[model samples]
Target: MNENLFRPQFDALKLSDKLWLMQTLATRYHLTFKELYAFSRWGQSCTTGLFEKGGREFVFVPGNTVILGWEGFVQGMDKANQEELADIFAEIEYEGSVEGFLRQGMTPVRQVTIGPMFVGRKLEEIGWESVPMNDPRITAHPDWLDALRKLADRDGQSLKIHETVRFERNGDSWKAWLCHPMTYPEFQRSLLWDLAASLPTPDEWAYLCGGGCRTLFPWGDGMDYSMHLHHFESPEDEDKPFDMEEPNFFGVSIAYDPYMREVVKAEQFTTCGGDGGRGICGGLGIFLGFLPCSPHCKPKVQEDKELNGDYDFYRPIIRLENHD
Candidate 1:
């Protein structure tokens, strides 16, 4: 049987399509508030104001956009509902604790509450000022936060946004959201492939062989660096852990790998082998030997004009292709 058949026909649809499909589904099946809430993982709204779904839960900050609140779960149905769906006008009631749900390992079947403080400081916390807004690193976090903040600040009151969630004593909720921020404009997401496609391939390759020599920087048009790597080195063992000294390798004690049969001597950088070839081959974990720069492509500006305002978190990098 075609799995898509039992599944909602519009399961693959975007958020916009899901909205219309949900309304149509509700009207067609005549689902009720309680049933819809059960299907959706929404515990309640406005009164006890619990929006519990799956194993997690939330408290709705009333007056926020209705679509943002409920639009995430319309397509994925866990099971078929036999109860007649209720109309919005019909009064329904439920009681659950959003706080309680989150305390457990269970997550709300879907995402709703935006992590407020973490999002507010995403750009400043990271080094956005060092890069351009159009830069991949620059746009990702701010764009995502903007979307979330816009959702929270719909009515534009801090208290109103906070009021949107009140987790019950044993309800599921968002686990620690210290995760990094996200950028948008590529529609769904900017996979690494997208970043690679934007970068123009280098016309030439320069090889490095000297023990303390760095290779020619390789980068082309479009965003050249999608990410960065950090290395730490120490030379002496201290009570704390280790310290950097004359023979200090980058981020580690200079260990001689017998298999490679090479003595990884201390280099100019705090890393082990500083020879040109060793520095250029930088992949994390094997060794924190060198820092390599790659292009990170930024997507075209979004169609939404409202998103064109200045972003405090990112500086936009514009690289003009040389016509010559």
Candidate 2:
């Protein structure tokens, strides 16, 4: 999860290209390495997710922990001139499926990305029918669907006829893309095993899993919930820990891992109704030798300096406005 480890990976890249990639990512995510590590609420961990947006393919095989954030891990991974990195950019250049693209290689990459259109085509091929009502898992929240429905129902809208269909069509593709693996859960489970099997040793999986679990506190409540965005801003009053017998209604819990010098704690802030309940989940953990002077450590602040100028380059491309 250490970003510095990735420096060796990118040794062949021109400095400008490296900086450009860093800036593009920071702009897209609205994240700084410091801010990310100091404020990741999901606990300390590493996980990989793949995405194919519009016609673009990206294999974000992230190895981030609470300490190293996405920016750090990305820079680390890009440090290499490996085929994995080349494959990532090449498929993204052409419209392609992550799994399909990776299969072309002997050692397939860990993640997969089938974008909206591709996923839609698969759904049609499968003959799956739509649910009459929106389910919480399908939508980030009910209101997220409601907002889109309101747009479709606007007066004089060409979408008036079969408005639900319009709402369903536009959003379903993206949801399908996100949940595509869920449809083939067994297949994906096999993938996990394949990933474990391919690792240098099976024991490494246990080490990674143990390291990753320390990074996320499961909100195991059966109810569907969204990760509240307000967790990142200013801190508010800290309350006494909840009583053990009291029902845990809050969405997530704090996770601290001493080995990583990582601390994942939730800081209180307002929630849904502005009714003053606590749900501002913030995660900030420490990494040993984040500062200079420790063995095998260097100041990661250099990447920040390199990224400053190009940080907002992605704004016009796919940046979502006003997410907060």
Candidate 3:
């Protein structure tokens, strides 16, 4: 019985066309009838802010973008929308608690605020620093020390430096090691789950890097070797730290680096990015070394293997509300 006759012609229609079609549908059928039909097609999930289609659950991310699939949320976000979301993130107060780590100096914990279609990067990698015995950030609480000791023991390592503090810092920072891909997920479950924050997925990282760009680097298709900083230059040359480099379209810093960022996919495989050192200017040089820093690049790493090096670091994502 040719059901095609009953189906609405929605394909090939623009957004305006779709709206016009809806208006026509509503007029031909009673408004109530059209409403019922629309609800039957998209209501359940739409009302719940979740859409299940194509075997994937489309979750509503805060701001104008919706996470349609794992590929990249920015694909659904136009430049204006992305900028608007970034503005929202820029205005959001840091409601989360700050954990101060005492090293040579007190390093207050800081996190970059990013929401759907927005982006962020850590000022520096997480590292351990030595602090004075009397540093105010030092906590001698027996329970805290016990917990630290237990964590070290579980890692089969002995705890050193009674006054040691962990922190995220720039300049001479140490790498996070002996941690598997699940490490960040477990940490989120233990600490940040309540805050509605978690480690970023691979897709999130890629989006943060490229936004909608398919370029060799996030900023553009070309990389001027003159802009290369910190790695290849002489000591007398100005030190242009990657973090201080101009931000990408989404205000994310340090899109490419000799160091690798540890990331996870579906909480299963360990992957790394930004490790490829340097390459020629364009996509043609991707195979040389630029591929590691390419937005879509996902260097494979064994899930079970603990990435024990200074190169591996993780970033966190804070989930924002769709409404205030």
Candidate 4:
């Protein structure tokens, strides 16, 4: 059997032909296909869609050729967006700090071909198999007062976002979450067992976030200052809630916040996004704060100095390459 029958060059197919092919894919693989891209000043948006397995959802990123890295903050992003970002620059310190870092040797540019993949929309939480619960699940628990009290009692007054899961109990059933910093092997083992998926590569992570678009953020180049980016200059600012990890056009949530460094694959032992909340809480200003979301940023993953920091998370992806 041709394993790659599910993968096709969508750009070459005509509109009607595309629809016909999409139908086969839908019926055969339980995948839904959609054309979400068009040619533009920077480039065409990557074709992204959706699929489901194990009662969980995933964003399907189609295969395509794309430029992987670039030189300057304003280089890959088009002119109009450059102008917009410059205005935001005026509100914060530039020359000595963020600008110097940006001006330095940026992520080296090179064209690369990426294959289709299904990316998880949310970070994976561990420890579901322990109790053998029939309906195991995990979700954000902001108002978990009992768990909060227990956490504070065990650790300290402040609510930490680390290994501890805030589990809620019910008769013969329970749910758990808040475990964002699981090691790669731990997540890999669970995910592969559950959905036959694993974490994404650095390049795949880039495509998931930027989708080959020459823009700063996933949606576009300009930043929406209205959304809190986890960067704070004062104690009062820290009080503000973190932005919800919303899905990008590809239906995956990634590279949005600098505080959460998502664990990546390979022998090097590195992460794809974030500085582990260092820049966000370090008074580094807004530019450094939001830099994690940009695909062009170099040294894509660096070692976080803090010990077993709560800033780590995992994003599992199912590669659509030939099983043969």
lDDT per model vs. reference = 0.20, 0.23, 0.38, 0.57
Q: How do these models rank on TM-score, best leading?
A: 4, 3, 2, 1
Write the number of the candidate with greater TM-score, choosing between 1 and 2. 2
Off by over 4 Å in 1: 1-183, 186-214, 217-229, 235-291, 294-315, 318-324
- In candidate 4, stretches whose alpha carbon ends up further than 4 angstroms from where it belongs are 1-23, 26-48, 73-100, 103-105, 126-162, 165-182, 218-222, 226-245, 299-309
* Candidate 2 per-residue lDDT over residues 1-324, each given as its tens digit: 224213233333454554554445545653331111111222333212223433332222222222211111211212232343355446448455432432342121122211110000000111122443445444655654565566556532322112123223444332222112112223223334632211111111111222222111122111111221222212432243322112111111111111121100112110011111111211111111111111112112121211111110100012112321
lDDT of 3 by residue, 1-324 (tens): 111111122223344544554454334322221121121110111111222222222222222222211222222433543353345335554332211110111112222223442113342333433454334454544654565556654553333332233422223332221212235445446335433335556556654554434333444333345455434455655555543244443334544554455554455546555552433332223222444665555445554543433455555454433431
Per-prediction TM-score to the true structure, in the order listed = 0.14, 0.18, 0.43, 0.65
Which residue pairs overlap in candidate 4's backbone? none
Model 2: how far residue 301 lies from native, Å: 42
Tens-place lDDT digits, model 4, residues 1-324: 222323355555565664564455555555554443332222333343455566566655667678877544453545554464466566564545434446462466778777766677787534322322232332233445555556545653344334554444443334444444545456567678866778777877787667766555544544555566654435655766555355555666677677677777765456766776666576655655677667766544445332243556677777765632
lDDT of 1 by residue, 1-324 (tens): 222111233234454543443344334333221211111111221121122222222221111111111112222212211021121113233233322321232112222211100000001111112232244542455644464446454543321112111111112211112223233323112322331111111100000011011111111111111222223323331223321111111111121120111111111101111222343243222121221121000112233322111221111111122221
lDDT of 4: 0.57
Clashing pairs in 3: 175-310
Top model by lDDT, which number? 4
